[model samples]
Target: MKNIAILTLGLRHNYGGILQAAALYNFLKREGYNPVLLRKYPVQKGWKAIIIKALEILPFQNLKGFRNSYIKYINNIQFFDEYMPNQTKIMTYKSQIEEFLNKYEIDAIVVGSDQVWRYTYINDTEYDTYFLNFKLNREIKKISYAASFGIDTWEAPSENLNIKKYLSDFNAVSVRESSGQEICKKDFGKYDVELVLDPTLLIDQSFYLDMIKNKSPKNYDCITYILDENTEKKELVKKINVECQHKSVFNLLTKSSKLSVQDWVASFKSTDFIITDSFHGMVFSIIFNKDFLVIINKDRGADRFYSLCKILGLESRLVTPDSVAIDRMAPIDYSKVNEILDQLRVKSKQFLINSILE
Candidate 1:
């Protein structure tokens, strides 16, 4: 079997990040490739590393800085322990990445399925490692599958040339959003980019169905999976629950619920309705054929939601906080959505196969 190394945002405490990484890994495994997640640790050294270690050791429960850092660490540990055990190996430096590439004899490196390409996400660094900045042999394939820019547009005047140069080296490139395709063409002058489904969507619903099979159901009428905790969004969910009698709303991520990734999938599968601003939340709701209302999250890449909804013919389901009159809205016609997904699934699978096999 050919060895494949997936470079993604696996260390994030977010459900979408973890699940998408799993989805791509699982998909590659099913395709008969030996896939491993490249766990790239931050290149903290000397005083910086020592400071972090000190903070970790210090029991400053009263200090918000120490408390928040501790919580983040705990959450990351929990995610890796429960969901991604034995799937990852560490690469702490650029030399380590190069060493790993040679050590594993990896056939290809797939960068992907998230906002890994976004400058802000990479601490505003130019020529992020996600763009495959490392030196490598010319023959080894570099593919970008469902990689997203996370915004409709970007203004990286200084990095434009570098972006184009790095992206030019890819054997194949596919983006998660239509806007991404546009950006590649307009910004980088790369017209050959293919717009493909997120890795989360590329997998069959049955894949997720199996993961959630034996889990107990959540006792709620609606599940709200909003990433942003704005009062307007919160109040809209509350209004919907109150107006739609017998429908109790449960907020998921905002409350920092201790539900594992699998547990979250099960809860989403079992919920009667979904109220979400999260892209993956909207995705799962559609995949499971549940009734859902998408709140527009302008700050968090709302373009992705719009593009996907438009493709699936469910743009009507996307609404602003001001448009939360649930009684007036019609149920989603998922028959049409399923048909679109069926067609896109074939196309996305072909893209993956061609990117890997060709």
Candidate 2:
């Protein structure tokens, strides 16, 4: 079996990041390839990091800061220790990453299934790394599977130049959205870029269902997985809860209480309906055949929602809080949705197979 190293966002407090990384790993493994997540620690050496470190050591760290950090640490522990036990140890520097790749005898490096190419998450100097900049043997394949830009537009002229140069090295390039395909063509002049499904969507619903099969179900009429705590969105959920007075509403976005990945899946599975501003939240809802509404999150890139809904022919599902009455909308007829997904799944699977094998 060929060994593949996947470079993605670090295992952080975010549920989507952790789950997508695991999805790619699991998908490759099921295809008879050995896939391991390359754990890259964030570079924390700016004034912000300095100030945080000083606060911690001076015994005067504010209670709010301490509490937030503790919660993040606990989330990381649960994700790394329990969910992703086979992930590589922390690789802090570029040299460490190169050494680990060589030591593992990795045949290919896949940067993907998340915002690995998102400029905001990375420093300017490290742009090439996401493009697989490091030296490797000529026979080693360099590929990107469902890599996302997280936004519709490209960076500055100089940045685009650098991106174009680095991206030219890839053996295969696949993006997560249609907007990403346009960007690749316009910015990098890479017209052959394949628009692939997100790693989570690449895997079947059965993969997630198996994990929560042994767990007990929770009682909830609605699950609101709002990532952006917008006042209007929260109020909408509240209004819906009051209207459905007979059933209980569960808010899965509690700040202090972070649920395990399995618990997150179970929450969605057990709920009668879902209302969310998260991309992944909307995705799982559709996959599970649950009726849901997507509140466009402009700040966090609404292109993802637009692209996905357009492809799946669920554009009506994406709406503002005030535009539609949650209760009045008819139940989603998933026949069309499922048919579209079936075709997409076949194309996406073939893309992955061709990217890796040929």
Candidate 3:
């Protein structure tokens, strides 16, 4: 089996990040390849080592400083272990990716299913890492699966030429958003990029339900997952619970989430409805087939939601905080939505097959 190295954004407390990585890794393993998740950041040294020492007293594993919160962190770490079975022990960031790949003897590298290609999110110095711009000792297949620009429009960086050069080396490229296809051709001159589903959607909902089957998730009439919460959102959710008689409600925040990864997936199981400004929150709501409304998190990028809704024929679900009319909204017609997804899966899986095989 080929040793496939999967690269994406850092795998931390974010539910979407972990799930996407797991989905791709698991999908590849099922396809009969040895897949490994690669976390950026190798063993720290120099100034980074000093910063680590300074933050050591705060919390690493034990309940020394933040006793009440440290245990929750440990649970999250355990969640990481459960989802990612085959991952590198130590991570290497930026240009060091070349050495890390060599050390592992990776046969191929797969970049993304997240905002990995969103130029603004990447650092100026390390753009090479995400773009796969490295001088390797041996030639290995480099590809991107559902890599996203995060937004609809393109804003070329100063090093556009370098990006084009890097992509020229890629064996295959697929993007999460259709807009990325235009950006690739218009801005980067990479004309052959294919639009595909996010890695999370590559797997079926039963798999997620099975992971949380026995976790005993709490039932909520409405679950709110707002990444950038404000008074407007708080008041809206409060009114929603009061007006709709949603007695059991919960706020799922990854930053302060105490739930395990499996537990997090379980939280979606019992919720009748979902209110979120996050892309993945919207995704899970659809996966669970729950009635939902989305408040676009503009800062995070709204194009992803638009692209998804357009694909699933659920564009009406997208609503703004000010323009929301709860009474006027209608239930999503998932029968048609599911039909579209089922057909898209075939095309997407074919893209992967062609990309991986010669």
Number of the top TM-score candidate: 2
Residue range 300-341, candidate 1, lDDT tens digits: 788889889889888888889887376745677788889989
* lDDT measured at residue 44 in model 2 versus the true structure, 0 to 100: 74
Per-residue lDDT value at 97 in model 3: 73
| Model 3 residue 247 lDDT score | 81
Could you give candidate 2's per-residue lDDT for residues 96-214 as a string of tens digits? 77777766778888998777777776653466677788764345688999998878986555678778877887889999989899899898888889988898888999888987887
Q: Candidate 3's residue-wise lDDT over 1-358, tens digit each?
A: 8889888876655778778888888788878989888777323468966755455445544333343244544566666677667777655555467777877778889999899988777534465788788778888899999999898876566777888899999999999988899888888899999888888888888779778878887787888888888887777766666766778888887455567778777887788888899998888888888888788788888999999899898888787767555553567888998899888888888898778787
TM-score of each: 0.90, 0.90, 0.89
TM-score: the better of candidates 2 and 3: 2
TM-score of 1: 0.90
Clash pairs of candidate 1?
A: none
Could you tell me the TM-score of candidate 2?
0.90
